[model samples]
Target: MTDWAAHEGRCLIHLLPDVITLFHEYVQRNPSDPESGGILLGTVHGPHNQVVHATPPFPTDRRTRCSFDRGSEGHTEVADQFWRESSGIIRYIGEWHTHPEDYPSPSGIDLREWKISAAKRTDGRPVIGLIVGRKAIYIQSTSATGKALVYQALLGNCPALGH
Candidate 1:
């Protein structure tokens, strides 16, 4: 796992190797695509949020030169299965998508979507948002308390931090 401190060290974000691998493969497979993304799943422990799993882009996902719309087709079923298999340990935590820029930053749409997702959280916990860019990957966590912290990506055994 890779750890990142946010909110001036108030929150810790951990990215698992598996999730990183998934993102790598997805990006490699669609090297020329403008955007691609899916769901993020994991568990939360106190001030630490661990992301351990991620879904591949759905077949029905809408992709464009600048945006990615995660399709819902079969998503609920997959999330339910993951929750059940983990014995309620893992749950839907956030969303991740790709950007064509070297250092991608969230757009207005991204911020709005994150706020909506945070507001609907049943556990009142923050929802993570990730953007995989050509050079670096950006991560953010937003909570019900209106705190949104951007995390610094920590690459663990991954070829490069900004790959």
Candidate 2:
């Protein structure tokens, strides 16, 4: 597991082992490989949010050397399936995509997309934006109230962290 705390320390985001693997598997390793990404599925409880699942890139998604546009085809179906299986405990908590750079950061398009996602949430929970680079992963969360928190982790042997 990998852990990150909100800016104020009021919230914590846990990306489980499986989710981390998924992110790592899609790294833009090859110079020609376009970016890839999918929606994050997880469970939220108070200030602790656990990311348990992540959808893989679908053929429907649009990909370029520097950008990824998640299509609707398989993402929603997977989210729905997980929601039903988990009795609504699992859900779409955020989005993640790959960047060709070694250390990735959110682009202007990413921030705008996150803002739109946060606004669509009726439950007021935060929306997560993750960018997986060749050597690191960036995580940012925007609360329903418009507050934001961010973190980044370097990848190696996938060391587990937190209690």
Candidate 3:
């Protein structure tokens, strides 16, 4: 067996169930329109790639008239509210949403979002994105960490994070 502890550097991840439940419920409630979105919170370690499938308990922001201009609106606002209203939880390590009857894999648009979000979290902290329906998640590592795009199987806690 491979000794996970023997690795040069290890990245640790913990899936927040409360968060995941919220995400699942959000997707189930809004499967088609605007999809959904939320924040990821976690700890970072050495230049390792780790993916965490977290649920967002925040509500979606449906304000504003324009769909394009609205952005993640209510959903993102919900995330912010959770952060603002919480007793004490780390800020979103990344974001996630549902993919209808599809797998939880990252898409081109998802990548673009990661690029922007990762740039914002330039402190070597990776952004974890989850495509909930198919029960999948993606880990987008920062360039400065000397790591490549890592994909892990979220059905269980296997943190291979392969490119």
Candidate 4:
């Protein structure tokens, strides 16, 4: 498990070990492996959030060495199902993709997409953007008002992150 904090500790994202393992499974380690990603599903608790599940890439998703475009099919249905099963507790919180670099950073396209997503949210909750790299993960949060912030991991000792 890892805790990521942003906005002067006003917001926190707790990534469960399972979620981390799921992401690590697609780290883009092979030269022929394309980028893979999916939707982030989690539960919100006041100012804190716990990421419990991540949808896997589907056949319809567009995957390239440097980019991943999530397909519409299978993604929404999974989110809906989780929402119903959890009594509206679990929801679509964010998106995540794998990067080839060891220390990944958000690209211009990524930032733009996140901003657009945040603008479309009607619940006033933040939208998260996650990039899993070969050795580290990058996370960003955008508020309903378009305020963006980067989160830092509380534990600087994760083996996968090479900390």
Candidate 5:
């Protein structure tokens, strides 16, 4: 198992080996077609959130060649189950999705949605958004104060990012 740390000293988001494997499998399932996505579930430690698990694409999700609208159906139930199973340690930390591009960048709508989500969060912890592109994965952590820090994947097997 390996970990990736954000450049900014303020926040660190950990992507566990299983989570990484799941993301890669999801991307490989549909290399260049419709988008798929789900919520990020994990535990928050001071100044860091370790992403232990990520929900698979929901059955009700709306997918297209260029966009994905994650369905909320059964999401709350799944989250609640995770919370109970984890002894209330695991909770909704943020969101994640697949992008068709080789190196994905968040669209305007993505940023807007993330901002709104962050603002609405009552935990005061940053929300982590992940985009799994064909060649690489992008991660961003946005604080309740609206400060966002981009993270780089440190694992050698992961594709290198330009920015």
Candidate 6:
């Protein structure tokens, strides 16, 4: 189970509208063609479904160790923008990326990389791993059974640092 509380106080789990906005933005924001990506975030206030506060997509560049590897080094500007755009009412929470595949989940290598990311943080924030593609967002965590559907509203803020 990626702890729903994993990234507490550090990042935001964006809502559907916000998620969709990022999806569209990424596809158009970068000239990298298939290489472009963006971040998704929202302030999750819940009883299961509510948004007392929100944020928008913060654009960032994709950094990969190998050009073919589906991974990146997220830029700081994205996080900074979340603060700036949200009027200081929100902060960084997690990020999302797209894969050419209709379904994008963390690849084996992607999982390895996430572990490294989680290890570097001292704030106990949940580093969200989102794979957006084919009109769907799949959620994966330390305890997820398979792909958790974003459309179904499966997870919000999980506490699993990373698998």
Reference-based lDDT, each prediction: 0.79, 0.83, 0.46, 0.87, 0.79, 0.42
Q: Name the best candidate (by TM-score).
A: 4
lDDT of 3: 0.46
> What residue runs in model 4 are displaced by over 4 Å at the alpha carbon?
156-163
Q: Which TM-score value belongs to model 3?
A: 0.56
TM-score of each: 0.88, 0.89, 0.56, 0.93, 0.87, 0.53
Residues 17-86 of candidate 6: C-alpha lDDT, one tens digit per residue: 4445445554322334353444434453431222222223223343332213323344455556766888
**Candidate 2: which pairs clash?**
none
- Which tens-of-lDDT digit does each residue in 1-163 have in candidate 4? 7889877888889998888988878888889989999989998998788889998899899999999998879889999999999999999999999888999999999988888888887787879999998998898987766678898887673437433
Candidate 4 or 3, higher lDDT = 4
Off by over 4 Å in 3: 1-9, 28-34, 45-89, 134-148, 154-163
lDDT top scorer: 4
Cα lDDT tens digits for candidate 1, 1-163:
6677776677887888888777776552244665888888888888788888888888888988778998869566778898999999999999999887777799989988998989999988888999877666788987766578888744452224344
TM-score of candidate 1 relative to the true fold: 0.88
Over 1-163, each residue of candidate 3 has an lDDT whose tens digit, in order, gives: 1111212334444554455455545443333445555555543445332223343433343322111112444545544665566543435566666554434556677667666666676464656555555343444443333333554433444322111
Report lDDT (Cα) of residue 96, candidate 5.
Answer: 92
Structural RMSD, model 6? 9.2
